[model samples]
Target: MLVLGLQGSPRRKSNTFILLDRFLQEARTKGCQTFMLEVCRKQILPCKELVICEKNGECPLLDDMHDQIYTLLRRADVVVMATPIFFYNVPAQLKALIDRTQTLWARKYRLALTDPKRSFRKGFVLAQGATRGKNLFEGLQLTTKYFFDAIGATPAGNLYYWKIEKPGDMAAHPTFSEDVRKAAADLLDPLVRRRRVLFVDRDGAGLAPMAWAFCQIHAGDRIDADFAGIAPAGTLRPFLETAMTAKGIDMGFFRPQSINELAPSFSPQQVVALGADVMETVASRFEKDPVEMTCWELPTFDTQDSEQISRLCKAIEEKVQESFGMA
Candidate 1:
């Protein structure tokens, strides 16, 4: 698993930095690949409220956010954003990075683009404040929530330290390190256990979901399997759903999913593409995990014909069973 930790403290060696470092260190010990980026050290342009991203799906401002931070965010399975409280919220630099994610938000909600790797990604916040006021962390927590959402990650955990002002103050706090370690483990434990598989098709409307449903019924416990489309049609295929039900598999949750915009947060574990087009699409998106990217040659089935659809399902079932034996 890839864990990306973003430190948002302007002060060198501040409590917030220490908190993030400790959390990432624990994640590393759990056998995860960890990357730490200090946001204050990077030039992140603030949102000008130009609304360009909402329209174009790209930020108008040019800075480190586009060149570096966005790539880091896209590749990470678990993201940790840590910052010192600034006026009851996150520091300005970190806020800049968060604001720049409006592009990602626009792509999903406005352009209807979905990141295929989104389902497994998780996020966490580690913040520290000098004061112990009742609302010290409230504003920052809410901002972090939306920030995580924009990046297509669930806000799964947090560690907020109060009354830590000095550079080394967090280190002296008896419970701080323990809290960080526990939070990292809680966030990473699931990712370390199971191998994941993603099925791809021209539109998530067809064979991808069929393969997913069949595998889920047969070997759901052994692997994580999901389906996505190169271009999402935005609706479930009613016929495929009916066909699955006839086989005693209910695909109520098989909604159309787009292939990941960036390399998936779920690393390229195993991608089962319905045809060469789907395999090529997955290849273009993810070049890091080449070993798991393989194509199987199979005859295409016509969705309009009911007989061919049953034959297609039967073929998928056989392939899925073969995969189980291979695993």
Candidate 2:
């Protein structure tokens, strides 16, 4: 599982960051790949109310936020926003990024495009405040609810603390560390036991995501599959997305990720390598007691025709069913 943490505290090493770091560390210990984006340090411009995203399913903005942060939110299985309460709400920078995701909201409701990641992804909040106002966390929670909805995640839970005025106040809290450890375990245990991991390559982009969808659709209760590439690409090929959409799998939120970061978390019982290149890469990276590795000569969306992609997806689905002992 991948967890993306948005650290919204302007003060580095503040209580909020410390709490978020601890939470992420705990998540990592439970075999989650964690990424933290310091929102205060990034240049995230407020939404300009440009409706281009509503029409084309993309924002017109050409900034770091669009290029870097947008895809990160889409790819994460779990998203955590950690912020020190600023006037009972989130920091302006993080709020701005939240507003920009109107594009995703539009895509889902207006254009009838569903992000497949939404079905299983989870979201949370971690906030700290010096004052003990009852409503301090209310505004942030509501905003986060809408934000998480737009980004295709369920608002699973949160961690909030009051009267944490000093830098290390959270450190002194009696149950801070223990609570975080428990929370991490709560999030990971279900995922580790139930989810099936899919390690793929750039060549398998066309096949891997489709196979994952099939597994999710047919055997989701018994299996959870994820895809990653050895030599990751910039984005999913447009035709591949189109092909998957035909099968009712939304590919709008698809993005390539490094296998190095994913492999450690998923000691897969079965590995499907789509091509010779992928087979070799997986073999070198993972050395265990010979899990079944099936190789297919499936060309990527870039090289394959429409008919080829269709045939390959069907073949991949068959192999997946066989591997899981469902066939």
State each candidate's clash count.
1, 1
lDDT of 2 by residue, 1-327 (tens): 578999998887888888899989988877677899999898888899978888878888877667788878877778998988888898798888899889888888777776766777888888889998798799888899999999988888888899998888988899988888888778767765664557476644556666766666566546667777887777776667877766656677567667776666666666767678778878777666356566667545543477877776677778777867779
Which pairs clash in the backbone of model 1? 116-260
TM-score for candidate 2: 0.87
Instruction: Please report, as a residue range, the 10-residue window in candidate 2 with the lowest summed lDDT.
Output: 295-304
Q: 1-327, model 1: which lDDT tens digit per residue?
A: 568999899888888878888988898787666888989999998899899878767787888886677767865678989899999998888888888888888777876654534666789988888998889999987898899998879989888888999878998999987888777777788776766778888888878888876665566545556677889886778778667756645343236768774134445478877898678777877776654775766786676888888888888889988977733
lDDT of 1 at 235: 70
Q: Candidate 1: worst 10 consecutive residues by lDDT?
A: 245-254
Residue pairs clashing in model 2 are: 196-224
Which whole-number lDDT from 0 to 100 does residue 11 have in model 1?
Answer: 87
